[model samples]
Target: MLKMKSTCERCRAALTLSEQAYICSYECTFCPDCTEALSQRCPNCQGDLVLRPPRTRSPTEAPSLGFKAKLEDFLYRA
Candidate 1:
């Protein structure tokens, strides 16, 4: 789950969970506005910046339960 991280890594602007942001391999985060203004290179990893998935409350509040359910759902389907 996403923590209380609410700032862009570059501009340090506030970023809500619903905001479009990019995250590097190392999870270095930046807002889309900042990323678009600059090249789509991760400042930390220098790798491609990927869109971060929205974090759900269950991931943070009930990590084990959510993880187990997701894993089981995938495993049994196969």
Candidate 2:
């Protein structure tokens, strides 16, 4: 899973999951200002930095059958 890093590696700017950010293959994360300053290249890996996809919903907010429901289903199956 892609780790949603919380700050820019270069400038230490706060990065929210829904905000614009950039990352490289190694998952070096940066905010937009730092990304532009670095010319969209990851300094650590010298890899091309691409725009990180903004997350619409947090993992906790995702729809799921509750734990009780899951356990009941499993017990029934067993």
lDDT of 2 at 61: 81
Error of 1 at 9 (Å): 0.8
Write down the worst ten-residue block by lDDT for model 2: 56-65
Query: Which 10 residues in a row give candidate 1 its minimum summed lDDT?
Result: 55-64
Tens-digit lDDT track of model 1 for 1-67: 3443678988999877767788877778888987886588887778887788775443446545677
Model 1, residue 1: C-alpha shift (Å): 6.0
Q: Write the per-residue lDDT of candidate 2 for residues 1-78, one digit (tens) a residue.
A: 789999999989999999999999999999999999999999999999999998987876876578967997899999
Q: After superposition, how far is residue 68 of candidate 1 from its true place, in Å?
A: 11
Overlapping backbone residue pairs in candidate 1 total 0
Which prediction has the highest lDDT against the true structure?
A: 2
Which residue pairs in model 2 clash with each other? Answer: none
Cα lDDT of model 2 overall?
Answer: 0.92
